[model samples]
Target: MAKFEILSLITSLLAIFVSCLALYRSRKTHSELVEFEKVHVKLSRRQIEEYEAKDAARQKTTLGAKLIDSGGIRLQVSNLGEASAKDIWIRIEDPDSYNPLVSGDYKQKIPYPSLNPGEDFTLTAFIPLSVTQQVYPIALRWLNEDGTQGDFRCTVSR
Candidate 1:
């Protein structure tokens, strides 16, 4: 072959080889980018979940109630929160539906001054003989240490 033709051929072959190398490098880089994106997405989701958990912990102030049958049915209210609650009050939601009579001194037992975490209070009440409802709704009101009021409504069942 002529010298010029051979050099031309070599040039063409070199161009083809360089293109293949570039293609392979691009594919590898793309695969690595895909893997990095997957890891980033996973980390982002984990961070979001952790932030939500922390937010809930900061916002939580829980008060719950239940009915117990020790000697008779009694309403037990509990402070299952991280802060102290004050001016706690409990009242029947529908007094007409479930007419309840306080067994003891109403003024002394109700509007409890304060309850700390894990503390509870109890009150005895008697349902009217004419009431037929199995469930009684009760409304609870309290003030947090920050002086913010919170309310919770729950059911007591026979």
Candidate 2:
């Protein structure tokens, strides 16, 4: 009876030691996983902020037009981005086959070279007096400071 009790005690001790070892390994792995998640979260946040900044910069540019008293119209392009845009060019697309009567060239790309932030460029042209509304498909392209190219397509209504 004494020998049997001693064997049982040894078995219990062995089982307890194995359980403790498994618990220690599990905790260590859990801590490592948490650390990896922290790094992933940091990287994700940085990418999101970069995209937001680019979107904000793109939204800063605007195209507008106004009718003048001399039977002509003035078209204006404004850049409200925080940084300057380089290699700026504009293209007018006639998708609907509606021809516009203008004195200046519309088929060629109008180059502005560099438009600083918060700057405006105005062009004056004689639009047809008969048309009440006109839709112009304007394509604006520019290069950012980081050598990233951006192209925007918008329609101007007058």
Question: Which candidate achieves the best TM-score against the true structure?
Answer: 1
Candidate 2 lDDT, tens digit per residue, 78-144? 7766667777776566655443435364423266677777787666545567766567676778877
What is the Å distance of residue 43 in model 1 from its true position?
11
Which lDDT tens digits does candidate 1 get at residues 1-158?
A: 99999999999999999999999999999999999999999999999999998765544467998888787767888999988788888888996776453746556777888888999988886766687888888899998876678899988887
Q: How many collisions per candidate?
A: 0, 0
Off by over 4 Å in 1: 1-60, 101-104, 128-130
| Model 2: lDDT to the true structure | 0.68
Residue 10 shift from truth in candidate 2, angstroms: 18
Find the 10 residues in a row with the least total lDDT in model 2: 61-70
C-alpha lDDT values of all predictions: 0.83, 0.68
RMSD (Cα, Å) of model 1: 4.6
